[model samples]
Target: MTDHTPHTNHDSNRPAPDQPRASRRGVMKAIGAGAAAATLGIAGISPAAATPDVSLPTDEFVETDGTEFVIDGEPVYFNGANNFWITDDDANAATEERVDAVFDLFDELGINLVRIWAHGEAKEGELVLQPEPGVYNEAALEHHDYVIEAARERGMKLIVALVDNWDHEGGMLQYAEWADAESRYEFYTMDETREMYRNHVETILTRENSYSGLEWRDDPTIAMWELANEPRLEQDDVPNDMDDLEPPEHQEILGEWIQEMSAYIKDLDDNHLVSTGSEGHYYGHWEDDYPDDDWDGQDYLEHHSYDTIDAASFHLYPDHWGDNPADPDDRLSLHDGADYITERVEDAHNELGIPAYLGEFNVNLYDHDLETRNEFLEEWYDAADAVDCNAVIPWQVVLEDTQDHDGFQLYASDSGSIIEDYAEVVAEKSGDWDGDNGNGDEETIAVGEYNTTDTTSDGLHNDFTGDGETTHDDVTAFFENLEDDGVQDNPEAFDFAENDELGFTDVVELLRQV
Candidate 1:
């Protein structure tokens, strides 16, 4: 949060555009109609096209190997900024100017990704995406459309998160209220609330971008879809009998949601990658065993291990977690913070076999000296490099100067320059990679070669009932248990064809493995 303003991601804590050459931003446009350019252009971001037909390259879409982010067969190392306010409900020329300048600066700085919120429901204002259950405000959507179209124009990829864990901007609590559920937790449990969530997801994904004339589901500029921003709940968030649902273990509640939601996203769009958008709290490999880690009820290892989650998303907030930037002796020391980066990044790759993303990390200018802040960031960056982390984005970078004084805001003209410098250094040598994304050169593996190491109930163990090996017996078991709750919950694990669905074809592919 900006000095506890808006929504800042991670810390298990609380939680645009533009008028220049704005796109028509009409709804229901085809996904391929992005040729419609902005009427006016920003200096750094995509400006208005000189011609009516601006053909974009089809190969530009980011391809993932589940270990790295790749575009056009080459692996990519992303160093980008996060700006959530570009799509703020109250849009004016200044807001558009800010968006233009930030994107312009990021493009000039060689940063490649922008993670922003696709979810927000303001309680007091008319500017909200989903004001009520299944209802959307298109006027508010025009702002969001500008953000996407502007990025697309600039050749920038985005990691768009769907919701927030806290109630910074009318998060899950608003959904619960709309559904008449008592607790915000009902947003995940109640049938009515769950459907409402799904409706929002579909609306966001399928809605046509007014400027780009492209449906969001088909937009290649979007690199990934996050289920939520730092999704987790405090232990006090118990299930209300009003939903008439049994309760899961504190952590399992979120774990279940992550698994289902990620899988659901995968079911809808195979073109883009999806993640939990959690702060990558650990379930398996935990070092400090800090009690605060448990406060959010998130299990990083378990959450990322789900079949459809393409990468591990986590954040770094040393100051909030326990680090007192003034007192170098704080428990979440700089060194410890660096170690946090290495541990999560390495664990995600070595254990779960997916790329680990440091979704948000920052040094609050209000809390530390410029020297201390730079050193803190350098330490974490080095750790990320050493462990081969796929992507490391700071808390946020903006163009406005007044916001620079906030707890985590980093304006491009000021503290954000620090990241600009860092991104420059990482651009040339950075090379954390992705898995094979059907390059057509991969060798055919034997039936038993579908390897997996998810030992717990949270993972996708190849071994049906026992050892981590697939066999005819396991296929038979799969057939028998097709209707079982566990199989129904995680059919992707058995989907040998690698299609994003679980159906008769998946069962046939399972049989072929035998």
Candidate 2:
């Protein structure tokens, strides 16, 4: 796994001039009280008096219209960033004050969306959300709730990834360890390990917001639930080269897991969309029709085959993919990467019929300076625009104070200057697409006009009374199914437990959404 931790600076102990001066505990207290009133304040205002008289739009939720994201029944476009640290379980790793400052920067820059990690594992001395299998930390969950509410207050949407593929903050491998499995791949195939994961998913989806009085499934601030962050299986002795590795059996196992989890999340709450969170790597085996590489395998296309998956996502790292600085001669140029992204975006739209997201991308700032990075991002933005891709969230956005490296951090002085310009371009392009000329004045269609794609199963399997909608009747039927068979007749429709069957957890999932 790549070491994403920021490089330590000798002067890191000193706060930057622009860093927030508030104490972490004070900020957390404010966040818990209410995000709209407490977390939006600038320096010098008392937390009690920091409440802004802003009214956030409560009804706007994002859905898909063909290959585009429709918000409030109108096509929505965005430029976003990944701030995985916002939901940091370690209170010291990410302070509440810094979180506020980061969102403040996002608001200033017109970043409409963010991707945050919703799962963290307790291992390697790191603070984690789930300290053990089937165990959770309430304070950690509250911190995440603060992030969701805080984002909503800022008019920004979030894509919350359920877990990490890498070892950082404990991931699939940790679950396998808990199950005493020999390999991380066991997390997918082993019944005990898979159950641990299912339990975690259920815990997350059914969790009620400590602050909002709403369950996570009912929260519209969340745009989607990502299955994992760049999920890939381990290969033996291959030196962890992501682009040049093979794991045929592991691929199949992951595919099954994805289908199971995607269906499980949908059964819990059909409102929000789900993404596979694959890195969009192409494997020759996928095309060669290799034995056991069936349609249910973990190919870029097959990962989206499940009815519950609403979008395709991929990450781009031209520098890493090409081993740029190590072998500059063989590195993929900015234009080359753009061409690759354009093709993938086109394929996603043409073949899958679902929107595609450039979920993560970044040029190595260590190798390229701010100007070159800016050029790279501009070319990528242009390429995405040419194909009408749904969104582009760079590898990361961080506060100027916490930056450990020049390449990944967008808060550096030079990069911040470049991003200010890039933000304007994105805002203008998005505004034109929405027919608002960069102003927030576009009219939205009625909620009933929102287009919903066909689900995997036919005809209100969970709708119980066949009333053309999911309501209280379905809730009653859910309980009945749980009591009678411990599984829905059509497992694909109401099997939220992801245990190949259902029981009490499925009931919890149904009632929370209802």
Candidate 3:
């Protein structure tokens, strides 16, 4: 497929366009497997049939059990990525082929979960899923249906974010603009705008898929419903640092909105989990009404507000959030960022007693080497693992074909790519913590004999190209084994890498130690 120049006025906040739309032939080819399965009555099989009696529950609902997510009555953990643009009209038009390609890559990387946008603001001359207040776009909704259907076919789950807090996609500010309100915070207080938002949520929850003949509320593929993407009441009109009033007076408004929206979603779809995508910010000393240093932290304020919210969601952007190294000239390291995330995870688990989600996080490639970024991710993952955080979804998973405007893209074809290694580790670690095994021990594979011509050796010692010693030749053979057999088959052999999972990092570290 050939690349096309993106529309010059395309929203800068959105991801770059995906590879030119897949051809009709490609679409049919991708769908052929699903079609064939359906013909054989094998598609969309019931959850019970897919899992063994002893396995974790595979039902439609995702519930919480004290800082852990329970699915099918068993605690579960996942590693996910945000692909917000998948449902955007400007990119792949949410076509089956494009969706299939994206899921295909995810499946290859052992990524069983994804987070996508369910709402796009109405804007003139732009692709807005909701073109106006109280209006529905059937075509855009159909695209979303395709997304759910595609995810089902791949055995993957989705986190569907209902709205954006930013104006880039017709968020709260847009709604306020429509209602002629003085500030975006009015979206919570104004009856008219509040009703409009409720109506939109109803439309989404009650939506019926044209292709699958199933209502969205009944679909098991949807892991959870996010009220909004990083919602905050502090916009330009109602900035966070205002004087004359309490520094964080907007907490009440934000809290009310989350409570209302969360209750509405729960009432509509009691089967699914719901969350407020807050950034997990803590109030400053002056902002807190009490003289005590730690009185009324944001985590305590926002997380404790709504009984209906199932989990606490937060984002981590060390560089963007100014949590980087003291010296600007020095490349940003993941060490400090990892500590910040660890603190947040500990607070959410120990303080709030709710399953915490690192919903959005990433380090820009321009500021750090790929190795450093990988190390940063490793630290964050380790922190989450220690605290038993429910899920960790990085900022994004851009495909190889897409043009990367920022260094956040994790998918690359390069042999030594750390992102590739990170994905493998995530895949492995996700399965290790089902809560069924109290020890949190991962399943290990007996390293098969490496056959030089039918090479015969076991463990990491199966160096096909060399005499008994592990050398650079073994590194070459290791990657070859990955291509042929995959990391799951010899996790111990692959454990040489960082992040506690087996991958290229092991090979790099092996060479370094020798």
Candidate 4:
């Protein structure tokens, strides 16, 4: 229960459900009034029929329960997208419309979670969240407020990161300049800069949402707060005009900062969860590509162990991180990306016993064709699921109108299909992720108001590829096979829609399980 020095060795890590799932038309009832009952020791899950007893977080926010994320006693497996420009504060009349459009697209795609930046520091001449220390821009704040309210209206949960490591919209560099720190690294260490940073955090935590009439700190729609995006220790980030600090010491310093900042945010807002938004670089895991290198300050296990932190987040850009040649372009292979994801997720979800999220990932289409990128994405998605990691949020899924940045932009038109497919995969297992917390405990009884659906079937799997596991390839194969005689004659076997017919909806449910 303690976040500080939390001991995470679960009784045994819950292995990903291996049994193929059988889907019925709808969820069975009486989940709370289980034919039997058991508990996860939290306060809220009730055994009563109306209450549907299951473990709940101490509060009604998206919370970490070991490797699962639960809300109102239901496990949430989200297919998410990120858009850093949502709060750009463009000062245009269309900003609110832009926010609505983005949320509308997310809803259309079944995306339940989104990651957006909360920090937009002042630049030479630009709109920003904080124009000066202890000062904020209402226009900028309005744009952000609208995003929160719009997401609330659309039933979306958000992960709002406090700052950025990059200087895209004046990140740590701007903070360093604001406080006149000797270096950007001082943003993490200098007392004055630290206070400024905390002041910004407080400003956000205490602000009243102009649109929602709800305090930012109390909104359940805001699922989690990230300390920063892709934060790195001075040692690893030395290339970015930072002076090299000593080894391990830099890690310790950043670790202390994460400890302090996470606790600080938790104190200001206990209604939501907190995470270290690190790219969770793993050293000494795989000898070849993942050699013993301190590429990022994120020692995954150590940083995520902070008691108040609820989730462990990492990003994947194999095109950027791969050292050896796995593909024709000498990039990291699909297997390399898979191993990287598995190690980090297992460490956080299994070893640290927190939900592991791939907060940003993309296979570059600039380097390869979209087909190649799609193929790699499937391998990575299965890798995360292979370790029971719930969410894999791609970097920068933007509206077709938004400008694509960093060659990682995923426009709704091109990559939106991937998001829809991922959502369907998790949706197919709707109630299965609930109390099956990998504790190896057969809930003594199923006597709750919920958690009553049975998804696993003997042989009726959507594993269309026959790869022995369901994955994105199956999604493709199911579509490709629609013209085959077997599929034409027996559409019922592929009826994911449960309408006794086969269609695109059925294909969306494939490649979900591997």
Candidate 5:
């Protein structure tokens, strides 16, 4: 009965099951002896019982760079939790009651997005089996259903990661053999393995739940399919024992294969969106061509940043890669973490020309180094908002007692500040659209009759117009319309005009506001 899992900030508010039944005496007092006959009917009605929830529509989903999920022309945000509960740990069981409690907490938090891991490796005993057709694992599949159903009940959205290369003891590279013909890990570059991954994805997309009796392929519950969790350039551990390396050739080949599979997944289940799991620390791997590679079929760019993410991700953290380099200025004392992250984010907008997300971030609550973690996150939130960055998904919510402690989960002693901090920030950042005057300063961009769902040029939200690829002028036109209609909304609507060149950063600011 000893708790093995790393304690998260599970408190009185920790997600728990719905109201427990009254005592047996009280139940008997109310129902009397007639309850026996009613129990017979409970079975038939239980599965068919109607619940207050909405299912996502089946159709190609469009998530904009500004973090909008447009399904059949409507916009939504995926505000959910990061559930890595399905791993083969002692605590790795997903019960319906536990799932229900998590869902209830999400609902309470007004969260609509959920991040679930779809680890692709098989396991031998408790150890992970590289490329072992993990899809065949019954427990894994069962947990998947439990998670999906829970999200459905809350009318939440999902960001599904196809592979979890970052978490297990060995990391994704350890499973490279499963990917390699010579190794135990199944590599996607291999046609057979790729096909299997594709088939498995197809199964998830097409499979209907015996519980909800609904298929997720067409539902909004699916936000996007992330290609891998922190996919890297190397198929094996790095040369210097460092986490990253520039495996251009390997990444190029792997990127192409991933793109093909991405396209394949999209083709088979056009209803939902598809993307890669957060790219982890390998920022150099992504390029302008990255999106065109097919893996970028969707609008969102999911990336991870800690203290190192000064450029692309607006979120900052306590430290960067490697042993913390001593800041000569002791910059840690200035709370300039937000500025650092924003500076990098701005550069990315100017360089890459796409909106980015600080997809995952959090401080280990149990870390004896709690103060550093807390201070780091405080500035991160400010930086995320200061630069108008996309979204932030903290590390995790709850931990199961069945799991061993690893310093990741947030226990009741730790999570209070972060949970409340994030909640407040999300609320305050909620506002009207604004325009970006590309030179760097943000301005008020009016909301015009831009139909994000339409393929017309000149519309604020149109990426493809009949005239050609959508242009900034088209976005400007939308703003003009909005201004004319007195609907000029958030300042995130307008693009910055640099010698008359309009770009997506401006549009994303506007779109995010929308």
Candidate 6:
């Protein structure tokens, strides 16, 4: 069912009256005593804080207009990088220096968001496998603390995942062993099993102490809680029950898990938004037998649209480990594909009438061609705006280990710069940066201009192409035509050429074969 709550709202956690110094000390003392910040209200806030409020809805980053994720009463445009595989089972493999550097650089790139995965083991503290005892340190908690504080300090939001369910992963195996050495985790279907997961999440949500004396439940920079990562079956698992559970029981079971946990999260921490980890378009726990499953209470409807996968959705590269689609150019284009996904996003928005998000999309920066990569992102953003997507969180941001042949970063180093850049971009496209974060005054300027025909058209919707053209007359004409006698329903039919993907020779050619 659709959430009837007003979508527009101000962040409730925004300190009213900006508490005095002595009051800050009292809040700190209470926190030190292990008091739940969710109970204290403004009396609990420090002089300067970015924590999520578990008590009030507007106190966090999750205020919505019954339709999309909103920030400070305005619709949010999440523009950030991703960091999924950063914290592996082995802490040695988890480059701390690189992680710090990555956060530093993210600030430089004008980014305002970072998506990190909390693998199953990372969540349960069991994944790390190593030579010695504790050698494989599941530094998930520590790393999460670091990212939360770092992102907040830099004015960037964090989309943190709670579980990773791709391979025969760590946490799942541990849980299975806990149930019975032979059973493959009974919780996959049991109600008690789902409740256990919910309880664990609730514990985290209610906790007031996590990162360096910081409380997660009230952190504004902490965007949303992800339920799990790509909870889907792999190629080798097709023959096994992993592809789709037998008797079609697990589909309903898993959907219930999502719904339960989603509700649990919303109830526990009304301030922050919550989402299931991005699920694959096909053969996923969410898609299997319940092909007709469609629920709407969750804040974000996340999907991982890659290039491959026999069912539906876009393609994912490098992992295209098979001999299909043998054309080299087709493969490369698919690797950097975006327009196709954009069109899909457009359709989803038009059809679903909900806030959709691209949870994770990435390529090895050092290996992928720069021009193609840039093109993909440009196309993705264009389509996102066209459809009013809630957010686009790319994978693996700011890790020092990350490198490009050209020596660049997916993240910026100066946090303020990135925040400013994002604020500017969002402001330029829409009006303001949702001012409650103390981001400053709203600037008024018509977003995109149009005309009956092309006359002095400048680059209004031409951001992705960077062709330097979005003028008044063209925009005016485009919208005018959209409102014409016969064109009432599908305003998307307007021919704003520069923003028109079908007419763009390069884009058309890119999608021609795919």
Number of colliding residue pairs in each model: 15, 1, 8, 25, 61, 57
Query: On a 0 to 1 TM-score scale, where does candidate 4 land against the true structure?
Result: 0.69
- The candidate with the higher lDDT, 1 or 6, is 1
lDDT of 5 by residue, 186-226 (tens): 35445666666676677667767666666767655667677
User: What's each prediction's TM-score?
Assistant: 0.69, 0.70, 0.68, 0.69, 0.58, 0.55
Alpha carbon lDDT of each predicted model: 0.64, 0.64, 0.60, 0.64, 0.45, 0.42
- Superposition-based RMSD of candidate 6 using all C-alpha atoms, in angstroms: 20.0
- For candidate 4, give the lDDT of residue 216: 88
> Over the stretch 328-384, how does candidate 1's per-residue lDDT look in tens digits?
577675557887888888888889988888999887766677777777777777788
Clashes of 3: 8
True-vs-predicted CA distance for residue 20, candidate 5, Å: 14
Write down the lDDT that model 2 would get: 0.64
lDDT of 3 at 510: 43
Residues 402-434 of candidate 2: C-alpha lDDT, one tens digit per residue = 654445766635455444454555544442322
Q: In candidate 6, how many Å is residue 52 off? A: 25
Where's the lowest-lDDT run of ten residues in candidate 5?
Answer: 432-441
What candidate 1 gets wrong by more than 4 Å, as runs, is 1-59, 239-248, 284-293, 323-329, 429-514
**Cα RMSD for candidates in order:** 19.8, 17.6, 13.8, 15.2, 17.9, 20.0
lDDT of 2 at 311: 91
